[model samples]
Target: MRGPDPWAAPPPPAPGGATGLGGAGSGPGAGRPVSWGREILAGAVVMAAVAAAVGPVLGLLWERLAPRVRLLVGGDALYLENPESQQAIAGDGTFLLLGLGVGLAAGVGVFLLRRRSGVAETAGLALGAGLGAVLAWRLGELLEPDRDEIRELARRLGDGAVIDAPLELNALGALIGPAFGALLAHFLCMALWGPRDPVRRPPVFPRWG
Candidate 1:
């Protein structure tokens, strides 16, 4: 018998375009295409936009509703005045823009840290919003109209001796507004553009394995 043909023609290609290197269609070289970085950037941008738009809307609504409820429940005696002169600060278009800028910055930061997907983004946004709200609240308290003025106003409305408590409520409002703004923005982005998954990837090579 002739020596086994050392170089017999390679077996015919498999039907349906299969390759022998890794068994059936497409060898180990084949891989799913991906654009992880781009997707992350896009996700961040969308999240930021969501945060900015929703924040102001929620803030204004809250302001309006809170006062109304206070008036209704407290009757004539219960009153909360919003002494802030800048309506924008109270959830106007300018504040919305500010919120947007802040949100974008947060998103960019998150993206840079490689926390740009799934629940990571959500968590990042939430953390950022909380911090931002706290900062805003403190700043508002610092810049608030003099406590004496509030005391005078309370005195003018008096049913009794006016107790001039430190403006704790004012500070609270300031803090709450930014927090709400951030939350709303985050929610909107998640609803409209957040990643489908919230879980992160497992590391390659199982620790047990």
Candidate 2:
């Protein structure tokens, strides 16, 4: 025999023997129970990263579209009140939508990757949204209003006139964005991938045992 005929099909794997692919351990789906902690951590980290990246840009846009007062200061320059408040309101509203979109995408991804929805993933989505919103709000806090305009309004109105819109996160937005995002994501996941699998416990008594 020429070295067992090179390139010839090897002997068929013995029944129940290691199939040269996997026997007791080794395969794509082979793994321990899913690590919920890891999943939550990963999701939170990703959401935070995205929020951090967008916070400054959102803050700038919000500031530009900031609300204004209807009256004039001393009959001269426009006297705007609560630029901070206006900016926060606008930012919060705008970013809430953004956060929702992100959540939807995330939820869809989780459903597809896992081939089903589960409580762990639902929690993960909520956790991620919360963390992301917090991070974005924190970053947006760095924005400032037009100091020149503030000083001018103050000088003309003899102090305590113009309401300065301080730089900060929109409180309502921060609170609602994460909640809405997580819920939306959960809904999307359920709509797309169906509900989670019900747990199967061992037979009550003895079946064939």
Per-model TM-score, in order, reads 0.32, 0.47
Clash totals for all candidate models: 3, 2
**Which ranges of candidate 1 are over 4 A from the true structure?**
1-30, 67-146, 155-209
The lDDT leader among the candidates is: 2
Candidate number with greatest TM-score: 2
Decoy 1 TM-score against native = 0.32
Error of 2 at 118 (Å): 5.2
Write model 2 residue lDDT over 80-126, tens digit each, in one string.
Answer: 55344445356566666665555555555555665544565565556
By summed lDDT, the worst window of 10 consecutive residues in model 2 runs over 200-209
List the global CA lDDT of all models: 0.45, 0.53
